[model samples]
Target: MIVIPTRLKSTRFENKILCDIFGVPMFIATANVAKKVDDVLIAVDDEKVLKIANDYGFKAVMTKTTHESGTDRINEAVSKMGLKDSEVIINLQADEPFFEGLNLTKFKEFAMEQILNQDAFMASAYKYIEKSEADNPNLVKVVVDENSTALYFSRSKIPFDREPYNDYKGHIGIYAYSVKTLMEFCDFSQSKLEKTEKLEQLRALSNGKKISMLKMESKSIGIDTKEDLEKALKVFKKVNND
Candidate 1:
């Protein structure tokens, strides 16, 4: 199941999930893309969000207003919904409207393989990005081992490019984990690296947990700031016109 954790307010863009994108709210657009891959659920934090989700004919569950992260929010929603421990849950960010259906399909397959092989309890994807683009803090950078297992994720540029390199691996905003692992991850104390980098995936890595990384091409735009939304809008228009 694909679960979108929807928080009403954001530090950078307030009520961003409700922001209009391509004639629909951003969260709704994200759900539409997710629906193409699997069952979609919106784990919302506000009554306004819940009402909007219902009006749009989407399944939603209310979570706590004070949850620190989307991961925590979805954990509550999944627990309330009584999902089985073995069920895989994809945690797609509500702000990532352009996370394509094809990428999600590939992500699901990769996640299943990782889970079955016991390679990692957590899974995510990354794509090769230009070194120049990697300088943008909003576009997170990830380094992986020979097996495509993630070593570290950071908002700052990684590896320092001791030698000139053309590309870096940029982390995508989506994640997959079984209900059991999700619950266990949330139980872990918020790690120093996680708090410092503001990247939740670090908590798992800091706790000596493995996160399998899938390398794939994706056109998803994660709308963190208003500037990101503007960029996405331009890309959206261009894609449609083409």
Candidate 2:
């Protein structure tokens, strides 16, 4: 099952989830995309968001507004939905409405494979970061070991590029976790690196959790600032027309 954590408050773009995109709220567009998964729910804090979700006939639940991150919101929703401990929960962001169907399908496949191997508790998508985006702090970079397990996540350019870079990987916001791992993650307090870098995934890493990165052919645009929303709206319109 997939859970979308949406909130009305955003420092970069106020009420971004409620903003209109081709006549529908931006959050609805994201929900619509996520509903393509096998099972999904929208976890929201605002009553207005809940009403809008119900009006659109999507499965949604109201959660506490004090949740620190989307992961926390998803944990609450998973418990409310009465999902099994072994159930796979994909954490899809409300700001990302352009996720490709094939990528999602592939992600599920890889997650199942990892579970079968008894190797990983969580998985996320990673894309080859373009040179242009390498220096962008907003585009978080990740380094992986030889086995492809994540070593560290950094906001600055990784590998230093001292001898010129050949390849780089950027973390995508999407994540999949087993209910057991999700509960454990929520129980763990924020770590030093997590607070310093402001990256929630780092908390797991700090605790020696292995996060498998599934390299995908496609990437989704997450709406952060007004410009990002504009670009995402254009992409959404094109996708809707198709």
- Candidate 1: give its CA RMSD in angstroms: 0.9
The TM-score values for the models, in the order shown, are: 0.98, 0.94
Runs in model 1 deviating more than 4 A are: none
lDDT per residue (tens digit) for residues 83-110 in model 2: 7788888888888777787787888888
| Per-residue lDDT over 1-242 for candidate 1, one digit per residue giving the tens place of the 0 to 100 score | 99999988888799999889989999999999999899989999889889989998999999998988899999999999888888999999999998888889999998877876677979999999987898899889999999998999999999788999766999998899999999999999899999999999999999999999988898878999999999999998899999
On TM-score, the candidate that comes out on top is 1
Taking all chains together, the TM-score of candidate 1 against the true structure is: 0.98
